[model samples]
Target: MSIHVVLVHPEIHWNTGNAGRTCLATGATLHLIEPLGFSLDEAQVKRAGLDYWEHVDVRVWPSWEAFEAELPRLGQPYFFSTKATQLFWDAPLAPVEGTVLVFGRETGGLPAELHERYADRFVSLPILSERVRSLNLSTTVAIAVYEVLRQQR
Candidate 1:
């Protein structure tokens, strides 16, 4: 079994590409939920991912609903958000097989309906500065993915 990094309605190709790189490094599968803002063939994405883009275990979904329909009941599903009260470190994450880490778009975070549905699973990375609203989408994914990896080790 492998960990999964899910990006729902991602708007930037570079972020997705960088996330793919992180997934590749961490042995996690990358799932993209459309409609995407940029085409996967875009040069910018390739530039960001370098030569490793093709090596990513990427799966593209038509929509969030479609992705959810086929979601595997791995270890546990954790949603990363800036609005969540629980910190990622505070979550009871273990390095179990098939752990799923879900992230949202760069501009809007996760949909409101998803928040309502998976309220308990929501986790946040601590931001001490009031000047920052949220971290970059790719950065958040990397942090969350490593957290799971660390716990499991």
Candidate 2:
């Protein structure tokens, strides 16, 4: 079983950097969709102050379409969004070979079309407070991936 975390058009380096670390920590693969605001280059990533970038498993995609084309090849792609009706914990995620949890950019989340396109597979972290909108990219990924690990165990 594997958990792949896909970030669409991520704007920050640290979030991606930390996300990479998180993926590495949890035995997950990090897929980054491009048109990125920050650099993913080795030097640029180091500015985020993480020393072990070399060990991080990261893949860069040119666009969401391109990423989506190959996403299915990785496994089932599950969209993560606050707007989704389904909760992450409620979903049945086994440690299967083809399970991916996809996320959107920090400011602009998964586009409406993408969300609507994959509504059945969309999910979110349960927000107890009605006022809470969403979580930070890295934090969200952490929670989702940990939940996946929990399910796997």
Query: Against the true structure, what is every candidate's RMSD?
Result: 1.7, 1.3
Number of clashing pairs, model 1? Answer: 1
The alpha-carbon deviation from the true structure for residue 47 of candidate 1, after best TM-score superposition, in angstroms, is 5.1
- How would you encode candidate 1's per-residue C-alpha lDDT over 1-153 as one tens digit per residue? 568999998998878888999999988999999988888875866555557888889999999888887775555788999999999999866645568889999999999999999999999999999999999999988888888888877
Q: Which stretches of candidate 1 lie over 4 Å from their true place?
A: 42-49, 95-97
In candidate 2, which residue ranges exceed 4 Å CA deviation?
none
Summed backbone clashes in each candidate are 1, 1
As a whole number from 0 to 100, the lDDT of residue 83 in candidate 1 is 94
State model 1's lDDT. Answer: 0.87
lDDT of each: 0.87, 0.84
